[model samples]
Target: MNKKVILSTVLFLSACGGSDSGDGISLNKVKSNDKAKCSNSRLDSCYYDINQLALNIMFRKNDTGVLNVTASVSGPKQDIYFTGSDVLEIHADGEVFLPTNNGADSLRYENIPDNAQIYEFFWYRNSQLVEYNSIDGITEPSVILSTSQHDGSNTITTDWLNNPDYTYQIHTPSLWCTNLNYESEMFSPSTGILDNQRPPYQATLQALYGKNIESLKVNYRSCDISVTLIAKNNQVNYRNKQKRLFIHHDNFSEHPLTLFESN
Candidate 1:
């Protein structure tokens, strides 16, 4: 037989699955294309820009003292999870985004056990892990509220945690109040002050009470701020070195307004 003919036969056989390299694309390569796994930090940084996130979480206590958590987030690239578990049961709620697409997500979990002081949550896409972290559990005297402004008026209202949670209000005018772009606990009941005021506004308000609970006023300021609560408290504390109105309690009757003033 001619050498060319032998070469042609070998080529034909190889095309017909006779080659040693195996026929068709290797199945292993295709199978290896499965989704990539990620650590909590890795996944979080991948989908969410930690620098531009606004996360608000509120926990309300039931009659039994077990707290229920509701979280709202803005500017997240994917879905997230608020998870907590004890030996007996798990408190897990998925699909927390309020609108469920591109917008913010609001998730609620009922009867969160009090055993864990901090709760962890996660962000995921296509069954792949993204971001996760632990949050402080809501104890007694917890203050949670949402702050927004319109036409030079800032409205501070109670989030889910406001059923006799605390007595206060943001009475200051000409202020820019926000969550300070934080993902952790805002008001610490032990200190009795609005400890965490999301940045761009550094004024912290103190809830003052004499008999019927008088006013929520700014006790700390980083700059020249001339503002007052609407109903009461005409004086402002600046460099007064006051402890910033510290209060801690197991129960209360009033939900005071929290104001964020900026100048």
Candidate 2:
């Protein structure tokens, strides 16, 4: 697949809401956390303060593989999604085949690290090696492989080039900060005392797809905030949930507290 084409498709989806389902499966709401107390008299009542949202996918292949995806408010107006995928595989004598071709190549058996399991082969358009993880073992043109931490957690680590010019490396870690600022402006009232004090926020992106990703969707107040980036990870995992809170003081008067993502 063309990298630019894939990136563009993901970005377009992030910007515009689509059919909400792909690859012959429909997405079902798994969980949500929404809590914003505003009476009918409040101007912000039109918006819903979101706490948390998550989606879980279970493949029909077997009970051993699953994907857990979560999204949370990072600032007054911003939200971030984190996802993780778990897969189980078969290895012969603790050795697995690592393929070099983009699905057309042959797999060569090698002694992989105890912590590493042959998953799939990652390739650039030219078929250069990018990374491999366990999920790739099941994907077409399986060139990428994935290895997990072996702690029974979904955390998997793979080799990714850190070159500055690499598109995926440029936007990560910084996009979280940039998103916080962008969201503050969007959620602030255009005219009011609260306008001057936009709520503060922050966000983090986790990769569930094994490689870096580019598009994400955040939900706030029944509205979805689409985030398109120069680069991002395929999924994100957090030791702790990303949280944001907003405080407004108008002419020496303080408004009640507002939480970004409720527990």
Top candidate when judged by lDDT against the true structure: 1
- The CA lDDT of each predicted structure is 0.30, 0.21
Residue runs of model 2 more than 4 Å from their true location after superposition: 1-117, 120-184, 187-263
C-alpha lDDT of residue 96 in model 1: 23
Q: Residue-wise lDDT of candidate 1 within 160-187, one digit each (tens)?
A: 3433323333323232223234222223
Q: What number of clashing residue pairs does each candidate have, in the order they appear?
A: 21, 27
Tell me how candidate 2 scores on lDDT.
0.21
